[model samples]
Target: MKKILLLLNICIFILGKEIHAQTNFPYYQDIQEFKKKDSLKFPPKNGILFIGSSTFTKWKDVQAYFPGYSIINRGFGGSTLLDEIRYVPDIVYPYHPRQVIIYCGDNDFAFSDTVTSADVLNRFKILFELIRKEYPAIPVDYISIKYSPSREKLWNKMKSANRLISNYLKTQIHAEYIDIDPVMLDANKKINKSLYLDDMLHMKPEGYRLWEKVIKPYLIKD
Candidate 1:
C-alpha cells in the first residue's frame, strides 16, 4: 500500500511539470521591457492590475482610460488557462496587487475537437483553487469571455465556457464576475460591427471604451 502511494505521488508531480504553463516566454520579456519604457514615460505601479491573455495584452490604451491608477497590464497574447496556471507567479503575485482583473480562456475555446468547453472550465476551477492557495484574501475579478467578431465559429464554445466559470464564481463569495460580454454584443447576439478590428479576433478602440466603462467603477484608489 505504501509503495502504491509513493508511485501515485511521483506520477502527480511528473504530470504537474508536464503541463504547459507559460514559462520564460519571449512575450513576457517584451512586456517587461514595455513596463520599463512605460515607467520612464508615465508612473510607477501603485498596486492595480489587469491580467490575462491577448485581450488584456492588446489593451494598449490602459493608462489613457484608467487615470490615477497604476495599472499593470500583465497580458500575454495566445495564452491558455494552463499557461496562466504556470505563469501566475510571474504575472500576478510578485506585484502584491490590491486587485487583479483576469480575462482568459478565449483561445482555449478556439480549438474545436480537443478539450470540451466544460473541460476548460475545469482547468480554470483548478486555477482558481491554486490561486486562492497563493493569495488567500486578495480579490480576483473575472471578465466574461468576449465575442470575437470574426471567430463566430468559436463563439458557442466561448459562451459555454464562460457560463460555467460565471456560474461557479457566483457560488463563491471571494470573486466578482464582471459582465462585459452582453454590452459588447449586438441585438443579434453577435459582436458589434464597430467594436472589433479587421482580424475579427481583437477589439478596436470603441470596444475598449465599453470595457473602461464597467471596469472603471471597480477601480479602488491606491
Candidate 2:
C-alpha cells in the first residue's frame, strides 16, 4: 500500500512540475493575440500553418507570397522551441493543418548563453513528437535556420543544429527539412547583406522572396 502511495505521489509531483513550466511561458501576450484572432473568426482547417519566432511573425505578407494556397501564420517574435511546445495545443492541434512549416530555434540560441546545437535539436525532437502524437503522417516542414548577418557569431551553432535536424528528418516518414541557407548566401558563400533589412536579423522583401521561391515547391495544392 505504501509503495503504491509513493508512486502516485511521484506522478503528481512530475505533473505539477510540467504545469508550472507551461504556465511560466514568457510570450503570453503573443499567444493572447492568437486567441483573440480565433475568437473573432476561427482559422480554416487543413491549411498550411506556420509557427515560429520573429522571422515568421513579421511575415505579414506570407499569403501574398503563396498564391492560391490557404496559409495561417501564428509566429510570435522572440519565441523559442520551448514556447512552441507549450502552446502547441492552443495554436497547432486545433488548426488541423495539411502541413506545418516551422521556422524557429534562432531565438533559442540567441537568448541562451550555454545552449548548444544538440540542445536545439533535442528541443525540436520534443516539438516534433508532440505534433506526431496528435496528427500522424501529416507533413511537417522544418525551415532551416537562415544564415543571418546580424547573428553571424552564432552561425556555426545554427548550422550544426540545422544539419542535425535535416539528417534526423530523413529518417522520419512525413517530415521535410527545407534548407534555405544557400538562397540567402552570396557567390562567395557568405550571408548576403542585401537579403536582410537594416537590423540584419530579420529578412527584407528580397530575402522573403528568396524563401518563397524555395518553399513554394513543397506546398501541397488544394
Top-scoring candidate (TM-score) = 2
What digit string (tens of lDDT, one per residue) describes model 2 on residues 1-222? Answer: 544644453454336436644674578778778888899999889899999998998999999999899999999867898778777877798899999999999888999978888878877887888788889978999999987788889989999999999999999988999999889889998779988889988888889999999999989887
TM-score for candidate 2: 0.89
List the RMSD of every prediction in angstroms: 5.2, 5.4
CA lDDT of every candidate: 0.73, 0.85
Q: In terms of lDDT, which candidate is strongest?
A: 2
Query: Which segments of candidate 2 are over 4 A away from where they belong?
Result: 1-24
Q: What's the distance in Å from true for residue 117, model 2? A: 0.6
Q: Residues 136-170, candidate 1, lDDT per residue (tens digit)?
A: 77777888888776777877888888888899999
Q: What is the lDDT of residue 36 in candidate 1?
A: 76
Worst 10 residues of 2 by lDDT: 5-14
